[model samples]
Target: NDFPLVLQVGEEVVSLGRIACPIILTTLLIHSRSIVSTLFLSHLGDVELAGGSLALGFYNITGVSVMKGLSAGMDPICGQAFGAKRWAVLSQTYQKMLCLLLLASTLLICLLWLNLEPIFLRHALGAGQPTRAQWTSVIGISLAFGYAILACVFTNFLGEAWGKLYTQDPDVVKLISIGLPIVGLCELGNAPQTAACGVLSGTARPKEGARINLFAFYLVGFPVAILLTFQLKMGYRGLWLGLFSAQVACVSMMLYTLLKTDWKHQAKRAEELTAAVGERDDLEDGLINDSNDER
Candidate 1:
């Protein structure tokens, strides 16, 4: 196929002889991952297809796209490192990034498992269909984790007295008293970092979020945690300290990225994408006025 592939090289134009094959191949690979499942559902029935498609769309919008965007941040760093012949650093960066992505994927998968009922209810699955086992597991997991987080918040705000609600054992209560405040401090930093990452992903600048994570978690946070945990003998508190520091770093970096982003440019690009899709939809109702006026 004679697909026009133009490139500007030193004020001169050039064309790739056959670019369509590569472009088509790339498009197929990227889309087929999601589309294949929808195709499988299509064979089941119209309802199944519709529901599957809707759930897939929701996930693509809320999760996978954001993950991909954050991963893109590695592109620049990897490319520059390769070009500069810093092979060791490039390898290290790639390893760290892979580990981070795997960790995030694991955590998200666990969360998905724990929230199956709510997910089903929100999607095509009818309400009240969730089994007793599903409800039991969901409630159990939620309570187990929820109480800890809730206690952390209460303890942070109310101080040592809040620990008394959980246990009468002096030793356990003392541990809780120490852990709650640390967890709360970590959470305070974590909230903004998480929000900033979501915002960055939504704006199509995932690479910035990736850089923030790399520097915050691997570079600064890990070292501090090790130092405090081993050298200072701070134990679990040191781990929480590391988390707080990393979150603060991430928040600061994301805040700067937010301030520097060119909103006008992003808006223009979004409009262009909307127009492209609009042009492709022949049944678009809003375009009726234009057609009528023309007739």
Candidate 2:
């Protein structure tokens, strides 16, 4: 008998939530560390606060973001392996990921140590399934819109007073009030794109996600930011607006790709990826030969 559609969807939501909630909480907790640090820095004076904030941002962009992105590639492989009960594959993949991350960390450290000039600039899940792509897409789009609305609400609610939470300096508060809302709006694009990327990874198609990000951020977003910041004199606000533009492009392209996806083909690909070999092959051969002799 086929499972009821409503029940199936409900199950999917629960499953997704099971995986997502812990991650969300962990992310919030991790970020709170930075917030706590900033609060302490604020007590030390503006220059100290500014330098500390810059260092934290720099570390996030160069170190944490890179590691997270690299680690994400494992989602598909490991998820498929687990689903297919390929314990060896899952174990090996985990080990390899550790090695890769260690090497990457080493390289990043060297690069950062060698060059401090670029510090002035820049900034920066899984796929698998019981064919969870559709539900995942819905959740992603919902989050995109939800975050956008929240951004607007909070921005309005806080109004000019929002900046006072961090500092009493009128100039600093003014800068925060102007820039924070744009940064919040950026989540409208960032949220959905992040979810869509997970779907791609689940389907073992991380390269496409990578390409989309490169095109969105570097090819499109960075240029727009430079133009608005330097040419339009919008300053840091322009920089964030540029980020918003990139995020919009990213979510648009990500949704387009996900909408166009062939889920059945992805399932078949997952099966192929998890197919057994070696000892399993030999064991199956022996069983078939014995059955033939009995026949």
- Which candidate gets the maximum TM-score versus the true structure? 2
Can you write out model 2's per-residue Cα lDDT over 1-295, one digit (the tens) per residue?
2233777667655655675677678778989999989988887888998999999989988888888777775666666666666677777767777788878988887232111110000000122343454555565456557767786667656756867766778998888888878877887788778767766665567778889999999999999999999999999889989999999999899889877776655655556556554555332232233333210
- Model 2 quality (TM-score): 0.78
Clashing pairs in 1: 73-207
Kindly list the per-residue Cα lDDT of model 1 for residues 1-295, writing each as its tens digit: 2122233221111111132235447658868877678657756765786688798888776767656644654443343234334456446556766676667667656221110011111111111122321222233323334444665567587655654543345765577677778877666556556545644433334556778899999998999899988999999888878877887787678667765655444433322222322533221232232223210
The CA lDDT at 32 in model 1 is 81
**Cα deviation of 32 in candidate 1 (Å)?**
36
Name the candidate that leads on lDDT: 2
Candidate 1 global TM-score: 0.42
Show where candidate 1 strays beyond 4 Å: 1-153, 158-169, 275-295
Query: What ranges in model 2 sit over 4 Å off?
Result: 1-4, 99-132, 277-295
